[model samples]
Target: MKHAPDFLSQEHDPRDPNPWLAMYLDRSTPIDDEVKRAWLADSSSRSRQVILPFVRPFARTLIVLFQVLKFVTPRKLAFSRTLHRLLAWGMQNFIRPEANWLILRHFHVGSQVLAFIGANSPAPVETSPLTPQRIGDVRDDLFLVHDLNLYNFVIRLNRALHAAGRELEHVAEPDFSMIAQPGLRLEDMPDGRFNFLDLQSSIELFTPIYQLLLTDDDFWRATNSLQLDETIGLYAATILDARSHLVLLNNRHPLVPMSTLRAGFRLTLHGLSTEMLHKVLFDRRAAQEAAQAALFAAGG
Candidate 1:
């Protein structure tokens, strides 16, 4: 029999009744506290904390300015791309290496979580193909990208189970009525491609302010929390099934807004850090080798 991964082997906690949900919720490792302490104690982290009050207003103002520019600037001007490159360059040059590692490791952990789910879940789960280039391409949109991928994966999984007249016990059944209605097709893209640069800018602008606004424990707790995971799964199903106008006018659950905020703050902070670490540590051949080893170990 295939053994559960080390992280998932722990006895299920009553607080999180569902094993799958429990798996998603338990994101910390034994070393996380040690690494977090080191990250917090680093000179750059300490300095940022001291100056955060002064920086918070400036950051918030820039976020508003960017949101305005995103709306006003014509796509023909391609101004957003220029801003994207500039912000990318700034992040590349700044941010301490220690902090960068913690950030990159966070995504690495997320990827592993997805892999474990795919390996063990009763329903088929397909995640985005992991590649260094794809990771690099997303840049500041990494958090959003990872999230959308997971959301889509869960939607797909739920659909598969429903089709077979089976369901995962204790998991919420996502409503698929919108997709079943006549005249709607899953392939239709009524709106053009999503404006990823808008997402990138929003994340790039807000994460630093959030880092300062939240206490260390609060920040870490949010990072580890999966409070919104199921909500995101349901929303993904809804968005995929609904027409563009309905999606726009849809009534959001009370948790949806907070979920979005938490996702942006948590994922962006780690995604940017991962990008910074990639600049110095990424080796394509070595990454491929390591991936192979992981697959072999997992009995893939």
Candidate 2:
């Protein structure tokens, strides 16, 4: 049976609000005085990796530059679909491991950059009923992009499940309704290409982190015959989590309908993967061209 997240039930008073994100914390691991001392024992020894780094600002610059270029050349987005289909080809041909690794790494790094550096915090919630000053408060444009991102995510997630001999039986809806709906799907794109400069910079991936994010174990579980309800619940929980975060940030019940967030998450994931695949394919093509040129020169 589907149940609401335990976080919601943990609130002692129904009317009382939870202001912080307690979800990312490890509630099961409590630190006693001894444990606390042990944990802080190495605090004096510092490492350069702990800091987020000033280089993030530079990465932000490249991300924006490429984003603008991708938007301007619609063909890049189109070709991304063609290249992404190769993952299916690899699966059928028994090279699924490497293909999956490439996909996960590309996706993980791009998403990490976008999540940590590209995206801004949630927009200020417009609490007061519609007024002239608050007219701009309802950010339809912001939600449009969010919806696009979500829509892409769902398509890729379904594709991932499909490769594992499973599929998402249902798509979850969010609390907010979006005014603009995307009409196109991955299948709608024709094979094509645009400028490759948008992909010149490699997305920096930390292998350890992406390894942790890989869904190979989950895929193996699916091969044992996962049921429809499992997929439904997975997506349903995601929608609830997104809504909960929004509710916390806004500090008020959202006026938006649930349908919006659900659709957006699905769309964005698909789009994000497509963009990542395009970069990988572009780099591969460049390497092949250079290799061919060198071979021809040696022969001459």
Candidate 3:
């Protein structure tokens, strides 16, 4: 016989706001007090918020740089030139008066390593695709380059916020309305390991954080299995207990719609693996030419 759904499934006060989050919290442990204490003293909190939203522009620039370096001869990108173009376009078209404040107010969380850094993930340098030789491309553009502008921006912004006396306390609440769900399933088989970047970045394991952000419409979108959703919810509960500011929604773009959010959730949860993430992030392209040359000489 089916027992009544767990207490969480019961309708509760909407004003309570984050019950899904709260239920998940109830099932977890508190983050280390030392971690919160360190964040409180550090001015990086405000800077992280200020610099995070700008990450997508940087990500787009980096993605292009990634593509360019892959195909460019000598494996040295003319990133400095492209970077100038990116910055001019970004400052004029992307960053604006209204967006300036909005960008500074909320912490950013996207589907890339930049997003992870913005959230102050425990490990940044290790997860970053940046390296010494490849770092030049990042330096080429302030707006379009794969450089450390975002990182520097965070530092400067933190100084400004510290002067203004703002600190980001980790938040917790009652609703599950805006959380992300898991995307991977046991049955997907050999194809499961395909998306390399997601795997290396721990995206597959972090599906629960994405699941909590899904809506009722999204909840019903599953035609094949609901197991991933449940797994995602449970997994999200675990991660949230570790980082409260890791808010649950894909970056909502103007042209995108409700369904895009679902797809983003699927991508975050279902299509990731640890090995793939490491390969995409740490796999250096600058050495590709030398490595391939050596291989060709030895074999063919």
TM-score of each: 0.45, 0.21, 0.20
* Candidate 2 accuracy as lDDT: 0.28
Best by lDDT: 1
Q: What is the lDDT of residue 24 in candidate 3?
A: 41
Candidate 2's residue-wise lDDT over 1-300, tens digit each?
022223334555547644222421333322222212212221111211232133234444443444345445543223222222332332223321212222233333333322221111121111111111111222222212232343344455556556666532322322222111122222221222221111111121111111122232321222211122123223432433322211111111222222211221222233233333233323333565677799999999
Better model by TM-score: candidate 1 vs candidate 3: 1
Q: Please write out the lDDT profile of model 3 over residues 69-116, one tens digit for every residue.
A: 445443332334443444333323333222221111111111232332
lDDT of each: 0.39, 0.28, 0.29
Output candidate 2 Cα RMSD: 25.3
| Candidate 3 TM-score, true structure as reference | 0.20
The lDDT ranking, best first, is: 1, 3, 2
